[model samples]
Target chain A: MKKVEAVLIDLSGTLHIENTATPNAVEALKRLRASRVKIKFVTNTTKESKTVLYQRLKKLGFDISQEEIFTSLSAANDLIKKDQLKPMLIVDDAALEDFSDVSKFDGKPDSVVVGLAPEKFNRPVLNEALRLLLSGGKLVAIHQGRYYKTSSGLSLGPGPFVKLLEYAAGVEAVTVGKPNVEFFKAALEDLGVADPTTAFMIGDDVRDDIDGAQRLGLKGCLVQTGKYRSGDETKISPPPDLVLGDFSNAVDQILSHIGQS
Target chain B: MLVRVLSISIGSTLLRGTCNHISSFTVKRLKSQASNMDGVKGLLIDISGVLKDGDVVIDGSVAAIKKLQSANFPFRLVTNETLKPRKTILSTLSMLGYNIDEKILFSPVPATVEILKRENLRPHLLVHPRMIPEFEGVDFNDPNCVVMADAYEHFTFENMNACFRKLMAMENPVFISLGIGKYYMDDDGMALDVGGFAKCLEYATGVSPRVVGKPSRDYFLAAVNDMNLKCDQVVMIGDDVLHDVGGAQAAGLKGALVRTGKFTKRDENHPTVKPDLIVNNLAHAVELLFGTSPS
Candidate 1:
């Protein structure tokens, strides 16, 4: 165990599973903040705008600041800005707020930004995206995670449609979120952590949160909640540094591990 | 050469034996060719948009079906139209001057009946008035399943709320949707199908319904199995990409898209519903299958 400089916590499964926060997560987050640990909340949720997401987290009693929340939509916004790209955004109507700065119009565009907009995934809309790509427009995916857990069951996420555009347009989408090194690195960089080895990445998803962070020299902890299936630890190579029960347990482990170091 | 074997099987016993052997070889060749299918043995045709839009049969539909019959291709109409019973549907087809059989028409009614019996479930039918006769013998007194279809006027707020209560109260109650079609073309325009409401119930109850029509793999398999052909051997011809083309292909059956009803140029490029073949109409799909000029 080492003194963790900053922590990148996964939001969806780790802190909250769709709206309702995980048991004891609010208390755990309060303790982490009290401990003066530099914490940033990261998510691959491209469904809603950051403002709405922030409001939701605030209502759910997480006490997270809007600046501390790092969403894929925000990451995609940064990528769009950095590249100085005019993009056709195909995200949820509520999520359109995140891309208001970007120029959006009919006819041709430089890139096609896609996210989870179930109603917008029809034939005409997708075809428009395809035609743009065929004409050499860039395909930018917010996050290419396959399916997301809903209260009902697993529903198709933006990944399938993103892949569809990729297959049809014969172009590889530039993914700008989770499991992408740049997204994780950007979060840590914001916290003024030059060395990722001093940071810990905690999440329920083994590949995106744990394994991805581990590759970038960060200590990764797998929390068995939110989309965590049985035998997930076995699915990853060079297993996570620690596997804990839930977000509450994970917080306890993080504190003890930091003390030992 | 393969077409003759179908007729020869019913001729002389000696010829039947020879035809059986030849047909098996041809079917085996078809199975191999199925990997990169240049031809198909049978068809699972869609009725509504492909054949007729609303009450009126599309022009050349009768001729195309007759040509398919003469060509000796084992075909069946796999439709999601659960609004009407079998007798009414058959009468309508016959009136339209197309010769069709009750056995070859695989709609969702019989499948619904079979499911009710197999699962030992009772029906709480939220369907069309015409569809009421289809669930004749099913017990409705002790409702254990919420059967949803295009009930139109019957799909009122009061009925849906009642069904919702029944679904919520029962332990592991089944939600049966005849077809999860987003909408269908009526004489007026596009009208809502059961899909949106099915999704509503799913969102409310947090349980996905068992779809027993069109896109469901089991439903497609039933029609494919009835023809005694492998999924690869049959080609589904329809207009809708999600239900008709994607459904069939997902069920291991090849799919051909017809740009007739609800079909736009974009459907050809939709990666999820990318049909194996795209044609102008049902006639063109049939011609592509048989490699012959329409008589």
Candidate 2:
């Protein structure tokens, strides 16, 4: 009953760490895309916009269009639509501006959608949002992912700041990014697939991507090329379904798993 | 009587009769209310930092549970209280002055037992020997499930070795224990939880035992099911992030972290677990749940 519809490749650690592909990242995507497998590059990292991320991935040797990339930004936009509420506050940021096509909130958002926005996380902004939230505004966080690796070193992701905002606001959020069912649902809908098992999530991190896929009953392939290595598999408390060297061999494994079913 | 009539007939008889006879106006109002809650399903709440902090529960936390119950807000205690049996644990919370519905209490003990039965265990228990009085009907030979309750004196190194032996023999043998942490309470100060012991055995075995208590996803799911709430509708109440928030997230439940009891910045940022919302304590979490600001 399982048919290959799409292959959702994780951005950081899965495909490329920063400017370099993890071994066979480009070739695997090329082979999969060539074989008519729909490709959607999903990333929990929202440090950059779709355009910047696409450019970055291209430099790393993977050919990806903006149409096939589903970032936390994309997920947040979809959440706003699904929730059917607009904000009154003027969101002055490039990430917020991306949803200019959609209707804007009239005055102060009934809910604030949070992703990995770099500039907007501060005590002042958080306090302002806290007031709105205390007055019954819902907060939707993209994911609880905390850290993301960069060319320089490890930096805190949007989740930490979002958590700070949550502390100030004192309101729990509805998350939409990685491991959240909605994120997977959106990707699968884009891929035109029904079940999650038909898809395989290949990532370097055990917790964020691979384990997340296992929760959804999807076959997860943990690649030892990025943040973690082959021996580091012991660290993942709840381990992944399968372990692989890197994405170069991932295509063959994915093809076989999907084919066997 | 209404109750008698409801219980006399077979399933759906009362529902079909009562539901069909409602006035059109009332039906319209109900329909509107239903539509307002179109996508709003039951909340799957993680219990730890959101409700009770160690022994000191958040102010009005119990009252908030009462209010939610009155409003028909389907809530359950998705706790990873693997140390105590479900019935005993809930009753203890009740005796300790927390007004919780036992029907909605889904601890890992019963589910762990069910899993044990499925695995064909010889009733090899790592629980308090005194507590073994509860399992009169439960078999003792070739016990497949090894459960350890840390609160009792059963949490000794010898008991640990016995449990480990059972686990090592069985492939993926079910190991259900209480929260693996330490707590200092009013009466019970300086207590070691089962989590540390589970870690020790797991390190030795390399076979990570399935923790069924708070922070374990299985208990959360069971509690959600018991409350008749959808996974998305319930908000978890807990004070500890490692046992409460982490487990809730793992079980696909939302968490509200209350900075009470053993919650410090260290516990809040404890390595891997992340809580969705943070509050002063259980009382503050309740205020957020009820659309009110903490006083």
Candidate 3:
């Protein structure tokens, strides 16, 4: 009902699934941009760097630039730089390019940064992380998602692993990604959007994307794609403001509300 | 028995002035009935604080235990010590000149094993390395549950993560913790206990663990039932007020707080829990129960 000045788009399940973009997503995004509404791509995909993700989106024919994407990896990197921390990164090799400026792990670390690194989730690496935590090192989780949609099926996220270190060391980790309110606020701060109500977040996750945006007074549009299961609408109270078939439908609804359709 | 009569007389006398607030006759009758019917029949003794403080035997504890044995009283050493097996605990007590029988010792390890068998659940153990022998013959492959104890040095990230993954994979996860104590006195001094590690797994998996040790109602009742005694007919003696005294009182058993080992003045004036009895030491509690000094 309110005039939508800015829009936050979710990648992965909402726009594309790995290599392929969702049906009509590229064209819908182009149409929305023509409406002159400010757009920012907010994602919790911690598996790869922002450059790689941008490259993938470009390959999928989405007319997106690197500056428009705000990822959990970017948030974590900002936090690491702000804190001036010497961190021990437990992230994927592909994601390491983003943290090139930070100091490397030298057995003794001041913080332990965690993301989705399937290969590094073994005992020896985890034990080292545990010891660091026990010795009073901080834990920074990129995101606390339980699971995410993949080509095969749903796979485990870094949330459980983050909790493992937190529990064993008797410390609480600082999560830097959705549905953490600070993450959403940070993206809006970057866009210089002071009034959160003027923006809408379009994503597939009921909790992280939809509920997270709503908590900050932004309208949430949950698309039934990427990690969405049937009956997901009933999971959250005061359910998603808009539940549509996919990202394209979500765009259509937003455009029509703003008289851009 | 004498202690019960003494408590009744004191209680009735204290309630005499509060007749307007409560029915005095009913109070007297209830106290009389309780004193006449129920008396302490068995004792649940804490080992670490009451008997020995980290391998050093408390003064007069051995003699007090001997006195209890000679008097033919039924008692069990209820301990949350999961770092060692029952055999190791027995040997440690024996070496300290406190002759304790293995049959009367009650630790969470054996109780947890029973729970696993009863529930038909296989466990992925996150306990100490030395304590694994106690879980012999139990299936450990493709575990449906997680059993955590004081793994001490074994509380590594890898082990905790493995247990976390196992619990996450299960449709219905089962997590069992031996004890949930925050910290305990070890040789080095106060060290982190199993509860922190258990809390870690619980937080990660969103599974509330079934505690099989001190403070759990089932654990206290199990120890009482093992002595073939009713809940009201037993007393628990320990240094920790919240776990031992508070837990036992909550389970319908009388609790005695001993001023030894980890006991502090704060526990004496605990905000919530009022210990049923307070004594100087295990020897003092035994003297109060038997109405005589240990010979």
Looking at model 3 chain B, which ten-residue stretch has the lowest summed lDDT? B14-23
User: Candidate 1 vs candidate 3: which has greater TM-score?
Assistant: 3
What docking grade applies to model 1? Answer: incorrect
RMSD to native, candidate 3: 8.9
Chain B TM-score, candidates in order: 0.76, 0.65, 0.80
List the DockQ of the predictions in order: 0.03, 0.01, 0.17
Model number with the top lDDT: 3
lDDT of 1 at A58: 91
Candidate 1 vs candidate 3, DockQ winner: 3
The reply for model 2, stretches above 4 Å from the true place, is A1-3, A87-92, A229-238, A256-261, B1-295
**Model 1 Cα displacement at B210 (Å)?**
13
For residue B95, give model 3's deviation from the true position in Å: 2.3
Candidate 3 per-residue lDDT over residues B1-295, each given as its tens digit: 9999998776544332211222455434334333322478889999988888888888778888999999999999999878778888899999999888787898998778777877798999988888999998788888999899988777665676677778867888999989886654456444666766676567555699899999998898888878889999999999989999999999999988877778876887999999887666777567667754323
True contacts kept of 3: 0.11
lDDT of each: 0.78, 0.62, 0.82
For A126-229, candidate 3 gives per-residue lDDT tens digits of 66777777778999999987667778556667886786667657789999999998888889988988888999999988988999999998899999998887
